[model samples]
Target: MPIATIILAAGASTRLGGQPKQLLTHNGKTLIRQIADAALSLQSGPVIAILGSNYEQIQPELADLPLQVVLNPNWPEGMASSLKFGLKALIDEPVDAFLVVLTDQPYVTTDLLQELITTQQQTGRGIVACRYGEAGHLGVPALFDIRYGSEFMQLSGDIGARKLIKQYAGDCAEIPFPLAAIDLDTWQDVEAWSKRQGAGFEDQGTQPKS
Candidate 1:
């Protein structure tokens, strides 16, 4: 069974003062590139990125990578739109499962992704989420069996896969990942988190100094 990855990089970043957060630099590469590289490294299946907002600017950044790019014109509506667009593109592909990830999670690694994939395959569950923080927070960077692809496409509003996971909690499994909780949303958030991680602004390859 092949595992495909769908990276949602179409958000408006309204809370980040309208900047394309995925284009923000981190450790000598754009956040989106870092995420794409990590996902590609973990799984051999087709990797698709859903782009919107400043698509033109971000498109160039991913040109050299081996990834399929899909545009979400309805991205302004919210995350669900991007999710639907990506899933629609893969409707004809031979994918056995999917790992839905967000570009904002710079801390996500190939190892963590492989773990989720392995766990889902072993447990035979329809959904598996990464558990973050000491309290075991759950979010995206989740894996879903093809059995629930229809339910995934039915997702609406701004709510993500969490709604479906909640609907089928009895069959969902959570993997602890405290680092997944750290994500860049604002300049301040970027600096504060980088500082805590000892990742100076220079390490992020950004023009601005923290």
Candidate 2:
């Protein structure tokens, strides 16, 4: 089965005072660049990046990567629009599975992606998702069988793939990824993630106030 990756990088950084979260630096590289690099490195069919909001500004960052780029004009409608747009872009490709990933999850790696593919193939599940957090939240980076393409196309507004995963939980496989919960949503998140790399940042015993 040929698997393709769709990177959603269109969210407006409303919480970060208008800053582009995808442009935030982690370990010297911008978040989007980091995620794009990992996606491009995957042994998959095609890597497609969905850009919106600040598409022009983000375009240069990915100019050198080996991937297809698509713009989501209805990005203001939220994540679902980007998801639908990406799926539509890959309609003509011979893709058996699609992996939806977010650029803000700096910890997402080629290894973790490979794990999702491996689990999905081994268990023959139609959906494979990452499990995280103490409460065990299931989220991306997720892989879905082509059989779910129509379901994806039917999604609208702010709805995300998680809803689909929950609806079809019986046929889904999950891989635990505690760090997947650590995403860059605000300035505090950037600080915390930076601290992980030898920076002197105090954890303060609480999740960063989103």
Candidate 3:
């Protein structure tokens, strides 16, 4: 089945003192680009990057990648806006599923995503989500059957894709992804991540930390 991947890179990164988390880098690659590359690595289906907040700054990062771009003018409305906006763009397609991923999770790998799809297939479930970290947080990077399109549009302000994962708990499948918890949200987060990677970084703005 053809599955479309949506990279949720629209948030303003207000938590990082206005730093655009999508622009943050790891191992020399911008976070947004790295996530886009992971989705593309699957070659499973179309890849769409949702941009908002810092659309101008983040859009160019994916200019060289083969994927679709949809800008959510109401990104300030919250994650639901970007999530719904992306789904609307693909609503006309005959995609079997939609894979939603956030840009800040640097450790999201192709295998982690692939297992979500694989688990869904094997379990015959409508939703496949990542159960991450020690708490086994169930959330996106998630895959949802297209049958849930109307419910996705029903998602309102501030509520994210995870809401549906919880609302439809009966049909959900899970895969362990401990690294999903590692996301860049603050200068301290960046510092900690960089130290873990054994790398040095510049203060956040537009440049990738080296």
Candidate 4:
């Protein structure tokens, strides 16, 4: 099945003192590029990276990648705005399912995403979501069958794809992704994550555009 993936890089990164987590360097590429490349690596279908806040600066990171770039003017409204916009862009495309990706999840890999797709195909489930492997947390990088396209558009506020995963739990399959629990939401988070990886990061004083 052709699967379209959306990389959510639209956040203002408020917790990181106005830094754009999407632009943060990981290994060699920016977090956004890493995640975008992971999606593209699948060669499944179109990949979309939603930008907002510091979109002007973030856009170039994804310019060379073969994926759709969407800027969310209402990104401040939260994840829901970006989610809805990305979903709208592909809801009518020839895709069997949608996989929502997050830039902050440093460990999300192509294999992991494939696992979600594989599980969905094997179980014949409509949704395939990740379990943080902690407290049974179910969230994105989640996959939703095209049947949930309308629900994706109706999301509002900061709520994201996780809401749909929870709402339709019975129809969902779970993949154990303890690494999904490690997200870069704050300066401390970045510091801790980098330190754990034997790397260091200096807050570059990057300001948000939104």
Models 1 onward score TM values of: 0.92, 0.92, 0.94, 0.94
The residue ranges of model 3 lying beyond 4 angstroms of the native Cα positions read 202-210
| Between candidates 1 and 3, the lDDT winner | 3
| Model 3, residue pairs in steric clash | none
lDDT values, one for every candidate: 0.83, 0.86, 0.86, 0.86
| Cα shift from native, residue 209, model 1 (Å) | 12
Per-residue alpha-carbon lDDT of candidate 2 for residues 1-210, written as tens digits (9 for 90 to 100): 789999999888787765688787644677788888888788688989999988888888889888898988899998999999899989899999999999888789999999999999899999999999888988899999988989988888999999999999999999999999998777777787777876532222223344
TM-score for candidate 3: 0.94
lDDT of 4 by residue, 145-184 (tens): 9889888788889888888888999999998888888998
Q: What's the lDDT for candidate 1?
A: 0.83
Q: Which ten-residue region of model 2 has the weakest summed lDDT?
A: 200-209
Off by over 4 Å in 4: 202-210
